[model samples]
Target: MNKKGYSRSFISLWIGEIVSEFGGAAGGIVNGLLLYEITGSKEWMGALWLIYFLPSLALQGISSPFLNHVIKEKMLKNIQLIRSGAYLLPLLGYLSGEDYITIIGLIILQCLLGLVQPIYASLSFSLLPDLCTEKELVQANSLLDGTLRLMSFIAPGITSLLLIFSPIYVIYIISSLMFLLSYISLLQIPQNSVEKIATWSKKFWWEELKAGYFTFFQYPHLLKLTILSSIVQFAVGATMVINVPFIRGELNGQAWEYAVFSVTFPVGYAIGMLLLTKLPKNNLLMYSGLIGGGLSFVLLYFVPTLPLAWACELIGGILFPLFNAQSAAYFQREAPRERLSQLSSIRLLFLRLTMPLGILFASVSFLGINTRLTYLLIGTFIVLPGLYFLIKTIINRDSSAKHIRNIV
Candidate 1:
């Protein structure tokens, strides 16, 4: 364990995660840029994402049972290595100077990334409890979450700078190197940090898969958290689809203004990570974060100016980490240790499934909902439930207080 009370393994994992996230973010941006540069078709871009998301979600659904059967640390390292090689495909195609080959490479790369990400994420999440003491898990989660968000925030700017001096394909090489570095960082973790479950059968695989979902539903608190997280993801998906139109069209904002609006949330998220360490970790803070973030979305519906829109995103960014990191820690702590990997995969499947739903909700204009109204609807979806839970929490506390007073 380190001086901060985290195991060296955890620190290594954190470092690896940070590097990989930066690479992923930078590569994601360049993927779109390079694809658009080659094909110049919005439909193809959308199709490319579909190729990634459809298979990724499918794999996430069926892959949970396998997680509990594997060594998480090794799996994570292997994923990073695969990602490193996957990133090189586009660069290789570009070197060959064939647009079709480059496109094919990008498609293949996305497919590979899509398949591995769910497994990687599930393994890393399950490994977290092993990487730190129970007392240190929240802070560990916060640190990991914060730095990853920071990397996402930083990658775009750095990628843009790189683009100014080199071909776009060069970014892919850098991304590949980043993943290789991540793999090396992960290698420093002790091999025994995770133990694979010793059981295997075709029948057992089916049973474990069913058990993952069954066990998840058997825990109401975990289910509730997953649902809430899913709703947030749904809102996020909608925001992705509508933010451009609402900012540039409705608000008549410039490109720079829109960029600022896009960035404020992650910036606030980094700040929120710091703020969480100073605040008490409790249901109140967690629920309040959810409600506050929801309110930010609601406020976007009312904002008359571009700055207010930016403020809304910034406020949401600042508040969301409060709920996210704590809830994640809570889930990790509450989950049965042996089944945690399977359960983590189950939890992630639900979360991943919601984003595309939100995107569809926003994108389908036949619903006849305007952009602001969609914002209002998404915010309300979050806020009303949040308010319900918050009120229930307060009432429960009061009832307990009265009972205590009577007993005294």
Candidate 2:
């Protein structure tokens, strides 16, 4: 820890993450907006996300076997540079003056982006502990998680403003430049010596992967926490699909209304981020966040008007960071430093693997269920498990306390 309470490296990495997240978020909004303009199909919007998720997960599986050998900082810089190039590719297609070709270019961009995102995300998540002391881990994680979300909200507001005066494609141009800046900022981090690389052998690689998974499963709390977190990710996936449509389709909103609805969650998230550091980091708080967030969704199911729905999202956003920041810090602190990167990827694989399932769940109108009911279902999924964990944690604590008292 530094006298300023955060290391210079963490500050550097945090700034880079913020810039990169903003760029990514801006590019994402542009991708959706441009693609929707071209196709005007809700199904295609879902498909675009699938293109990103499927390839990303496949790469995560392929890359996890070898992550222990890679240098984190170098790989982060390389991925950002590649992302910069990838963001620029669609412009080339636009310049070529073919809508179909531009669409194909966008698919190609998404595929490349999918390939790199898992590695970048896992590396950065695992690398934070190295940048900050154990004491600083929770704050660091909160800062990163909170700001990444804040950027997601901030980008849309910025995009909405820019759309008023400029073209949507212009956001992509800005995004490409933003990523380049992230790459430059990443260069400030001093590199560490690379870990000893494992020699190549088919059998050896397979065994290493099994060992990573085996070790991951061995940590019962970690496994449990991961599964619980996966439920939230599932809810998140559904939200990603439902948020815009629910606000626009069901509530009869336009771009400005959707933008306002979008911004509130992250605005609440920023406030939660500030509040998390002042609160206790424990299972009770984490599970409360899970339950509170889920209830917020259930609240939306019955919200009779647009303003009420916005408040539901705001409350959900505020409630979730309690779990997100603490759980992330716990994962970083719990995983062994030597294997942290690989384990982090494995953990992410499990968490991310479910989101597509959730997206698919949300995308499909199962049995005539409305979008609000879909939100209710996803929320219920989160709430039930949260209650289970909350009860379990309390029971265990009471049992431990009783045994202590009996022994005394």
Candidate 3:
């Protein structure tokens, strides 16, 4: 696709992503609050998080062949319908006041989300070839990231304010509307003539599935990136899972403080997105790990006050997106388009699997140690393996530079 042609689709998807992210953020906050109200147990709240993640672990390999086999348009339409239904189910439960069934229904809804997300992920990358130049991919992804961060800035606060009046049904209405909009936007995308692989015999499906796993091994750079990303994901999940409890218990803060901290990360992320045009993209992984990871930990350690903690989060937010944007661009640049979806699915599986472990470990550490010490321990210990990979990748690249120059 030409630059002019790509712009039209890019603009549409960009708008869709923005709306969807805002609605997702709002719905997430409301759902958590409602669940807590219904169950009156932190365990259930944690379980909700776990349920949201478990599908990723289970579906990674299974989804890949299906992703490759299905038509992108058909896949997207089915996904939208599934997601819309998932959104509506909770509203029904909310109105009925059947707490037990509602909890079960909500778990089912999250499971549906887990199924649909990889399809969306695959489609999103597929669209890039139609919607962007190779050179524009980084900026395009940055725009998407920035939009999400901006939505994060507003959604929680808006949802909290709305919760003051009515929480449950409001979120349902909002989620439904957002999904509706997303479906419409997806419909606007022009279907591409994708080359389909010949139907494999029954034996081929198994081979294709195994191929997805082996593909990562064949691409060492991508393999390393995947491992590094999973590590970062684990760290992030641990922080998020513990953050609410930390603010509530250790700091003796209110819900508003939690809202503020949540908002801070996005604010910093917005700032980071703006800075991407000015910075070199090559060293993003290493720089983000050293700066964002280190600063986040330091803030958790020394910043006892809410205001100061927010400041640290803002700084960390600014640096973190650099890491994410560059990593995504790296995958897009290096991976074959036909296999991108499978690779992404596998990557997500590792990430989701490790993230819970990290959160579990962090939670256990918090049981015996002080919260600040737990933060320090995770920052120092858990995050190091990923950082080590990033450092190694950077050094290897530097070492290769001189050899390439000599060859030139």
Candidate 4:
């Protein structure tokens, strides 16, 4: 495609994702609050987090092959509508004055909504290469990253403010609206504009899945990237699952403080994305991981006050997106287009599974230790190796650095 053509498609996709992210952030805050309200127990709140993730871990693995075979654009549209409906489902239960049992049921429904996400992510990335040339991929990914951060920064505050006048249902209503609007924007995208295989061996499914896994392992560098990504994702998940309790109990703050803290990370993330737009895409992965690893420790150990925490979070926000954008761009560039979806699915499966696993580990550890101490220990411990590996990766790939410089 020409630059203009790519720009148009990138803008369309970016708008859809931004709208969807806004809805997602709103729904997340409201769901957690409602779950806490209904159950009135931190354990159950933790369980709610687990429930939201477990299904995606199981379903993404089980459905990977089938998801790989689907028509990418069509599947994305369907997924958006499914997500839109899922956002609306909680409203019915809220309106009906359902009890704890209903809340549990809604939690399960939310899990199912999450099950579609890996497939959605896979399709979205696959579309990017088709929509834009290789030279444009980095810039396009930065745009998507910025949109995500923007939504993350704004959505929670809006959701929390809405809660002041009304019950959590306001969040659900707004989330539903944003999701539907996202779906409408998605509809503007043309279907099956990218190339597809005409036919494959009946064994292709099994072979392809195996090949994806095998390819990931065969490329040691990529495998290392995936593992590091998983670790960082786990660290992120642990922090997020505990953030509400940490704010409310540890900091003696309200929901609004939680919103403020939430907004800070994305503010940092937007900064990172903006930086990526201007910086050369060289040693991006290594540098981003190093920054992220360092920031994680700072945010965990030294952010004694809300203001300081916000500062650390802003730094984390910046580094995390840089790591993700660079890693994703690298994978997209290196992976074979024919098997990209399957490869993407497997990578996502690891990322999803690691999150709940991290949360579980963190939750269990929290049972025995002070939350702050736990954060400090885990943050410092996990980050060091991550930083070491990231630096090693960059040094090992000196030629890749030279290639990156040439691109710039």
Candidate 5:
């Protein structure tokens, strides 16, 4: 263990994730840019995303049971190597000097990426318990989550700078190299620390899949936490569709102002990560974070100025990690060791499924929802439920205290 209280394995895993995340983020930026540059049609851009999400979601649904039966460290390393190879396809297509080949390569790249991400995410999440003590989980999760958010924020700026000096296809090479670096970093983790499950059986796969969902439903708190996270995801999806219109069109903001608006939430989230380390990880902080974040969204609907909108996002960012890091730690600490990977996959699937729904909710024209109204609706969606849970927690605490007094 290091002086920072994290095991060497966890640190290795964390470092690998940081490298890979930056690569993935940078690649995502170029994917959109290159595709739009080629087609010059919004419809084609949307179709490209659909290609990624549809198969991705399909795999997320059926892949939970597989997670239970594999070695996580090995799978994670494999995924990185696979991703490194996948990034090369687009570069290969570009060198052929054919737009059609480039498009096909993009389609295949997205499909491959979509297939592996859920597995990688669920395995890493479930593997955390083995790599760190239960006590270290919250801080460990905070560090990982914070850095990921930081990477997403940093990668775009770095990619933009790289574009000035290099060809767009060169970013793909950089992404491929980054994933290779991540694979090498992950190799430092001792294979003995990760438990190997019995070989998976095709005949029993359906049964295991059903059992995974059944076990997930067996825990009400787990269900509740997952739903809470989904609501957040839903809010995120809606914001993605509407935030540009809200900031640039409605508020008459410049491109730089909108960029500031985009980044403030993540910057605040980074600050919140530091705050989480000092605060007690209890129901009070968790529920308050949820409630506060929801309120920030609610405030966005009422903000008249661009600065106020930025503040709302910053506030949401600062408050969300309080709930996020702790809730994730709670899940990892509470889920059964044997089924953690399976359950983590199921939990992830639910969370992944909600964002698209949010996007649809915001995008559908007949819904008669305006930009501000969309904010209000999704914000209310979170706030009402957050309040119910927070009140329930308070009541449950009081009831337990009273029962203890009667026993005394």
Candidate 6:
């Protein structure tokens, strides 16, 4: 498909992503705030996210094989519609008057959202190629990424303002509406030709699932990259549980201050996106991103004030895009298009699988730790993987040099 430009389809998807990012970001704040208001425990927070992560990752692994047969845009639209519906569950729960029932409702809502997110994400990822050319792929991805981050950055400020005028539940309503808008925007995407896939037997479905896993193993480099990325995901999961508590409990901050702290990272991320395209593309730079990003969190752990913590988040955000954008581009370029959807799901499965573990790690009260220490621990986990790979590359380079010298 010699697609000449960013056609209506890609543009539509781009707009949808923008709206969706803001919606998701705002809703994330509401979730944390709402849960904390009710339970006041980091353990519940961890469990909340675990509910999201466990099924989300499990389904990503389970559903990879069938994605190829699915019509990407239609699947995407359905997911958005479902997401919009899911946001209402919490709002409905709150209105029902029973505290226990509200918590259970939120849990069920998270479970359903988790079930659908990977399907939407993976389909959208694999659909991009059909919408644009190789030259445009990186640019397209960068635009989508930067916009998402920028929206996330902007959403916090908006959320902070909204909180002044409205109750927390209103955010869920807004989020639901945003997803509806995203669905409406996506409706503008031009329909593309899709190949009909025959239904395989139960045994064949199992075979396809195995083949998807085997493909990841077959491409050792992809597997390696996915593992390295997962380290950061694990840390992010921990951070998700700790960041709010670290600000509120340890730093003695308010919702506004936490909002500022959250915005700083994505602001840096937006700036980082600008730099990502200008910098030289290499594995070293990408690896450095993991190290740099991890180091930011480590710095956050030691920060004595909100301003310093905000700075750490900003720097981390800036550092991450260097890795995130380039790694995504590499995968899109390398993965076989026919199997790309399957492989991308497998990749996402790897990335998202450890997040729940990280949450558990952070929430382990029996470990006798604080949020600051949790930050340090997870940051170290992220850095160590990159450090290992960097050292391995150096060792292999020196070994090759010695072999050539001996041959000469």
Q: Write the per-residue lDDT of candidate 2 for residues 284-340, one digit (tens) a residue.
A: 998999899999998888988889988988898888998888788888888777888
Q: Candidate 3 on 68-102: residue-level lDDT in tens?
A: 65567556656766776787777788788898777
- Residue 91 CA displacement from its true place in model 2, Å: 2.5
Could you give candidate 4's per-residue lDDT for residues 1-408 as a string of tens digits? 243646666677888898889888988888878877777889978777667667767777766566556778778888888887787666787777877555855686578676888789878987788777787777677778777768776777677788899778877778778878888887777775454553566687667667668877877766766777787778777776677777777878788888888787777777877777666775645455556655565465655677776677777777666667777777788877777787778887788778767788779878886667756765765567766766776677887788899999
Q: Model 4 Cα RMSD, Å?
A: 4.6
Task: Name the runs in model 6 displaced over 4 angstroms.
Answer: 1-7, 26-54, 85-109, 163-173, 244-258, 300-306, 369-376, 391-408
Candidate 4: stretches off by over 4 Å: 1-6, 32-51, 93-108, 165-171, 193-207, 241-259, 295-308, 367-377, 380-408
User: Candidate 3: which stretches are off by over 4 Å?
Assistant: 1-6, 32-51, 93-107, 165-167, 193-202, 245-255, 284-291, 381-408
TM-score of each: 0.95, 0.90, 0.85, 0.81, 0.96, 0.80
Highest lDDT scorer? 5
| Tens digits of lDDT, candidate 5, 45-107 | 888888888998998999888788788889999999999999999888888989998989888
In lDDT terms, how accurate is model 4?
0.74
Compose the digit string of candidate 6's lDDT tens values, residues 1-408: 234558788999999998988888898889888888888999999899889877887777778889877778888998899889888888888888777877887898789888988988888888888887776666677778878878866887799899999998899999999999999999998667485575778887899899888877988787888887888888887887888888998999999899888788878888887787677766778888888998998887789998889889999988988777767877887888878888999888877778767877787841688888888877888788878877887788789999999999
Error of 1 at 188 (Å): 1.8
Model 5's alpha-carbon lDDT is: 0.90
TM-score leaderboard ranking: 5, 1, 2, 3, 4, 6
Measured over all alpha carbons after superposition, the RMSD of each candidate to the real structure, in angstroms, is 1.8, 2.7, 3.5, 4.6, 1.8, 4.5
**How many residue pairs clash in each candidate at the backbone level?**
0, 0, 0, 1, 0, 0
Candidate 2 error regions (>4 Å): 1-3, 32-48, 96-104, 163-170, 244-256, 365-367, 406-408
Q: Model 5 clash pairs?
A: none
What local distance difference test score does each model get?
0.90, 0.86, 0.73, 0.74, 0.90, 0.83
